[model samples]
Target: MVCAAMLILDVLSPLLLLSILLPSYGCRAADIPEDATSEFSVRLYHQLQAAGEQDNIIFSPLSVAMALGMVELGARGASLEEIRQVVGFSHLLPGVEFSLLQNLTAALSDDDSHYVIRFANSLFLQEGVTFNPEFLHLVRKYFQADVETVDFSESAAVAEQINNWVENHTESKIRELLSAEDFTSATRLTLVNAVYFRGSWKNQFRPENTRTFSFSRDDGSEVQTLMMYQQGDFYYGEFSDGSQEAGGVYQVLEMPYEGEDMSMMIVLPRQEVPLASLEPIIKAPLLEEWANNVKRQKVEVYLPRFKVEQKIDLKSILQDLGIKHVFTSNADLSAMTDGKDLYIEKAVQKSYLEVTEEGAEGAVGSGMIALTRTLVLYPQVMADHPFFFVIRNRRTGSILFMGRVMTPEVIEPNDHDFDSM
Candidate 1:
C-alpha cells in the first residue's frame, strides 16, 4: 500500500531477495491503506539510513509489513496495538487490513508474464505445541501462509530447512538466511516471509555500452565499476527541499521496467553534495511529489551495475520504533495459542538486490560534447557517485525495494594494468 520512498534500480537485477523470520509470533488479516503504507516505508528507510550511516542499504518495506501482519494475527493487548500504531493501520476497521494486504499482494503477483514477483509465507511451529485453529485459518485466509510442524529442538536441521525454503522461493539469490545459531530449544514458532522479484528495464541498456568507470564513494574513496550508459526518454525532474538541511538542488529519475506497471526511481544529489545532506528531507509527501512531478523527457543516464545486500535485526529497530512489548515476556500473544509464555525471541530480515543490463542491447547516446562539457542538451543523471533509489509498482504504488548505493560494484586492482614492475 505504501507507494514511494527513497532510491536505485535494485530489482532491475536478475533477482531481488527478502526473507523475514519472527520466532514465537504470527500475523492475521488486511486491505492495506496506500498512504499509510507509504508513510511507514519512509519511516523504515529513515531508521535504516541512520543505522547504516554511509553503507549501502536495501530492504523490502512490504515484506516487513507482511511479516508483522502475520504476528498481529496472534497478537493481542499492547502487542497488537503497538503494531497498529507504528504501521499507521489504526484508522482502518479491525480485520480489514488483512483483506487489504491480500488484495495488494494478489495484484502484485497477478502479472508474472513480464516480470517475476513471488511471495512465500509460512509458519513453522514446534512439533508438540498446539496452535489455535481459528488463528491459523485467519493467517492462511489473509496471508495464504503455509503451516508446518517441525522440531525446534533440532536447531541445526530447522535452520537448514527454513533457509532452504527461503532460497528456493528467492531463486537461490539468498541462501543460508538462517543459521543454527538463529534457532534454539526455546523457539516454539517461526513465521517466515520471502519476496523475490526480477524485472527487466523497458529500455534495456546495451551490454557494449557498459564500460569500466570510476565510482566515487561518500568518504572520498573511488572504485572501478561497470557503468551502463543510455540516452532515452525517462521520467525526470529537479527538486529542492527549500531549506539548508539538504543541498538546494537534486535530481529524480523514474525508469520503468518491461511492463509500465512497475518503475525504479533514482534520486541523485549534486555531484559536489553528499547524499546525506539530501536524505533528511526524504518523507512520504516528498516521495508522492516526486512521483507526480517528474516529466517524461530524454535524458542521459549513467548508472553503475551494482549489488547491495543487508541483514537487519528487526527486534532492535522495532523497539526503537516503539514496538517493544511484543518481544518482551509480558507480551500477550494468546490469540495463537493458550500458552501465555509465548513471546517473540528474535526478528530478522535479510535482503539482497542486484542491478544489471537484463541481457538487452543498449543504444549509444549522441554527443561527445555532452560528456565533456558541464552543460548538455538534455538533463543527465550520472550516478558516478552515491545516490538513493526505490523500486515500486507504478500502478499500485507499492515500494518493492528501497535502498541507496554508496559504493557501486567494485573490481579489485590487477597487476597487468600497472607498469611492469
Candidate 2:
C-alpha cells in the first residue's frame, strides 16, 4: 500500500513561535552546514519517493528529523546506530548534532509579520509512567517539547487531547490527528510534531491570469487544471547528465516567497524523460550544482496553485530506512523511562501548505514600472506535467518541505477527505 509522508516536536507554548527570517541572538548561521541539511533533505525525499511512488507527497524533512532526533537521544546500542543511519545523524558529533538541531529550529521558527511559519513538538506519556529526568531535560532544552501525562486507558480522551494540540499548532488545517483506534493500553509514550506554513509569492500571480491548463500524469494521461501564469526575472538553470538530446535533461526554477529568504525550487523533467527517471539521481550534490549555476533570466512561468494535506504512519518507512531496532522487541528507550516496553506505538505527522497570490501584507512595497517597447519573446517554463519541488530557507539551505505533484487537481479549500495514517 502507498502512504503519504508524515513529518513531526515541541513545547506547549500558548504561542510556540520561532523566527525563520532573521537569526535569533547566539544562533550562529554556520552551526548547521548547508550541505548537511541538503543531504538530509535529498535522502528523505528519495525515501518518500520509493514509498509513495506515483502518489502526491508533501512532508517537512526538518520536522521529521527533529522528531526522530528526540527519539535518538534516548536510544542506545543498535537502536542508536540504526536511528542515526536512517535519519542522517551519523556524520556529526552527537553533541554537535543536537546543538545544530536546536539552533536550526529556533532560526526557522523566527519569522516576521509577513509569513506564518511555526513548528511545535510535544511528548505524551501514559499516566503514572516515570520518565528519566535527564531525557526529559534534554528534549525540553533542545526541542522545547512539552511533556504531558495522559491515561492510555482512557483512549478517547487521550486521542482528543493529542488531536487538539495538533489542530492548534497547524491553524486547524490538520485535525483529528489521532483517533481512538490508534491508541492501546500498552501505549506508554507518544511524540508528535506539526508544522503550518502560509506564504505568498514574491511575484504574485494575477488572479485573472489563472486559466485552465493541461497537466500530464505519470500514466501519460492528461487532465485540465487551474494554472497560475506570470512573466518575470527568475533564477533558472538546466540539468543534463549527458548530451541534452540523449534524454537526461530537465529544468530547475527558483520562485521566492515574500521575504526573499524562502523560496521553492521546482524541478521539471524534459517531456521525453519520465519524472521517475530523475528521482534516483536527486542528491545534495545535484541540488548544489543547480544552486551554484542557475542564472537570473526573464522567462514566462506557469505553476499550479496546489495544496497537499497528508497524514503518514512512519513505522514502515523508518524500518525500510534501517531503523529497525526502535520498533521491535530489541528496542532500547531506557533513557526515556524504565517503564514497560516503550516502543513507539504510533508515529504520525500531519502537514498543510497553501500557495496563493497574496503574500505578506507589506509584500509589495514598491510598485512595478513597465516601459512600453518592442517585447522580446522570452523562453517559457511551463510545469504542466509531473514535477518535484522543494521549499527551503534560502539563508540556511534547510528544506522546509518537499513533494511531487503528479496529478494536479482543484482541491476545494478545507477539503480534508484525503488518506489518513
Candidate 3:
C-alpha cells in the first residue's frame, strides 16, 4: 500500500482565480496508469530537488497540479499548452485529466474511522470582477470548490477570511497561510486548497521503548533525537545500483497505517552513500519496482519522532519545469474572463506533517502489544541517517507526502506563531 501526501495549491491572478486542496494516496504498482498525476509526481520531485538542495524540502505536487488544472480550464493558447506540458496532461484527451482527478479525490476522501482526512477547494473572487459562468460551473462540478466574492480593497480582512477558512479545514495545523500583503486592490482572484490527514500506525510504537539515538547528518555531524523502536512484520526490499559507478545499495521498508490502506515507504542508503547520490536515481519506474518487489518479513525498526513545516513560492520552480507562459505577459486566459490581462501573480503552498508514537491523535487507540517470542534476531532497519520517505495510498496509488529527513527535530506546537501574519 502507498501513502499519499496532503497537497494545497493557491493561485493569485488579476482576473482568473484558481485554488486546490487534495489529500494523497498510493496505488499498487500493477494498478498504476500512465496518467498525468503519476507522471507529474516524478517530474516535479526532481525539479523541487534541483531548486532546493540540501535543505529540508516538502510540498505537494498534486496540490500544484490541481491548482494548475483549474487554471487550465480557463487557459488558452500558449498558457494552456505550457501548463499541460509541465503537468504531464498532454498525454490525455481533453477533460480526461480533470475527470480522473475528481474520481481520485472522491476515492481518497472516502470516510475511514481509522483516519482523519480532509480535502477542500475554494475560490475567492474580487467583488467586482466578472467571471465566466462556464468556468464557475466546471470548478463547482469537478473540483467541488466554493466560490465567494470579497472586496480586495479591504486586504487585511480578506486575508483573515481566507486564513480562517484554511485554519478551519486543516484543523488549525496550518494557520495564517495568507497575509494582508498577499491581497491588494489590483488582485482580482485568489484560489485555495486545504488538506489535512491524521492516521495511526497498524503497529503502534511503544512509548517506553523510545530513547535518544544518534542521527547522522549530510555534513558528517550527528545529533541526538528521540527515536521510537518497534519490531514487526513489514514489507521490505533491497535495491542495488547497477552502474559501475560508486553508488551502492539501499534498503526500502513500508510501514502501514492502521487500516493497511495507506503506508510510509522509507528509502535508506548504505552508510557509504549519501542521500544526495540516491536522489538522481529516484523515478516513478524505480519506485514502482520497489513497491512491487518488497516482501513481508519480521524486522526491527527505529524511526525518529519528528515534525516538519514548509512554505514555498512555486513560480521559479514551475518555470524551471518549463511552465513559463502563465506567469508572463504572453499569458492568454480568455476562457476565464474577458478584457483582463490575467497572468498569475503568485503561486504558494504551505504544508505541515508530524509523526509521533500515538499517530494522529483522535483516530486510534493507544494500546499495542509487542511479540517477544522470536528466538532469532530480526533484521534491523535503522533510520539513523538522512533518508527519503513517501506516504502513499495503496488503493489509489497516489503519494500524499514526500520528503527527506536530514536533521530530525521535534517541533513543539506552540513554537510557531500563526497570529503574526
Candidate 4:
C-alpha cells in the first residue's frame, strides 16, 4: 500500500510497465480533498496515504511492476469504479509483488462468456506475466469449461501444471489451493488471487514463549489460535467501535518483517470477526490510530495460523448486489464495450489466506466470464446468515465481484468463488 499506490493510480490504466522506482512516490497536492467527495474514493485515497505516510522514502521499480500488469489486464471495458476498486484493493498487500499479483484477473477479456477462456489464457502469455510461469496456453484451454458439466479429467492435468507453476513461482508460498478437480462443467472460471505476506512486527515477537489463545465465537463456541506476543516497542491500537454501527470490537496490530522494517504485518481484528462486516472498519483514521497509539506492554497475543478459502457463485450474487441493470442481455454496456453486444455472464473469486505469527501468507485470485452477481440488498442484518463480501477499492468503488457462502464447510471451490477482494 505504500508508495506502490502511485504506480497503480497512474500506470495501470495506461497499460504502462514500470521497471524502476521513483525517488519519492504517492499522491501529491492534486490528489487531496477540500470537502465531501466520493465516499469510496475518499476513503481509499486516505487509506493509501495513511499506509504510505509512515514511510516517506523512495520506491523500487518492482513495487509497481505487478500493478502495472494488473492495470494492463483490467483496463479494457473496466469502469472507473472497477479500476478504482482494483487499485484500492491492491493496496492491501504488504509486498510489492503480491499486491501486483492480486490483480491478475484484471487482464481478463471483456468478451462474452464464450471468450473468457481464450482471453484469460492469452493474458498469461502477455509480456510480463512472469519470468517463469506454467504453460499458460495449455492451462487456459483446459479450464475453458462448459455449462453442461465438464469432464475435467483432461483439464485436471492443466490445473496440476498451473498449480505447480504457481507454487514454484511463489516459492511454495501458495499451495494446493487451485486444482483440476475444482474446474466445473460451468463456463469459464473467473477469479482473483492475493498472496504472500511475509512481514515481521515492527518489533519481533519471541517464538519460544508463544502461547495458546482461547478464541470465542459469536455463538460462544471456542477454539484455540496460537498467539505470537512480544512486549516492547510496536505499532498498535484499537478500532474503538464496530463497523456500520454494528457494535463490534477490534484491535489493530502491526508486525514488521524482520529484514524489512518498512514492510509490516497488519492484523485488523484482535479477535475473530466476520470479514464481510469488518470490511467497513478498515479506514485511514483507524490505521492512523494504530500507528500513533500503540504502547509497549507485556501482552499475551494469540492468533491462529489458519487459512480461509472461499469460492463464490457470482452470477446471482451480482444481480443481488444492486447492479441489476447491466446483466440483462438487452442492457447497455456502451460505457464499457464500444458498440458491441456484451453482458456479464459469470464472475467468480478465489482467495486463500494463511495467518500466523510470521505474518500473513495468502493469495486472492479472481476471474470472470461474461457473468456478474445478483443480490436482494434487503435491510436484513448480515450477521444471521452467510452473505457475500467485497472490498470495493475506494478509488473506483467497483464491487470487485461478489461473494456468498451459505455454508463454508460445504462450499464447492469449483462451482463458486467467494474469493474475497
**Candidate number with greatest lDDT:** 1
What's each prediction's clash count? 28, 17, 27, 57
Once superposed on the true structure, which residue ranges of model 2 sit more than 4 Å away at CA? 1-37, 111-114, 243-246, 359-376, 410-421
- Candidates 2 and 4 compared by lDDT, better number: 2
Residue 357 shift from truth in candidate 2, angstroms: 2.9
* Residue lDDT tens for model 4, 264-348: 3233332345433444554545434445565444333333333334333333433443334334444333432234233344333
Worst 10-residue lDDT window, candidate 1: 6-15
TM-score of 4: 0.43
State the lDDT of candidate 3 residue by residue for 1-421, as single tens digits.
1111222112333332222222233222223343356566777677667766666666666666677878888788888888887787787787787887777666656663456665688888877778899989998888899998988879899879987887677666555656676666777767776666666788888776665656788888776666778889999988887872326678999988877877888999876677888888888777778888999999898887666556565666677778888777677877888754777755655555566676543221221333232554977788878888878776555777777787786323243311111
Q: Each model's TM-score, in the order given?
A: 0.87, 0.83, 0.86, 0.43
Model 2 residue 80 lDDT score = 79
The deviation in Å at residue 199 for candidate 4 is 4.0
Write the residue-wise lDDT of candidate 2 on 1-421 in tens digits. Answer: 0011222111110111111111010111233455355676676677778877677777667766777778788877788788776666778776677888787766655653345655577778767767799999998999888888888768799879877876676555455656776666666667766555556677877766565555788788776655667889888988788853425778999887766767788899976677888777778877767776878898788776665656555666666667787666567767777642555534555544444445322211111322122454976777878888877776667777777888775533233321111
Best by TM-score: 1
Candidate 4 or 3, higher lDDT: 3
- lDDT (CA) for every model shown? 0.71, 0.64, 0.68, 0.30
Candidate 1, backbone clash total: 28
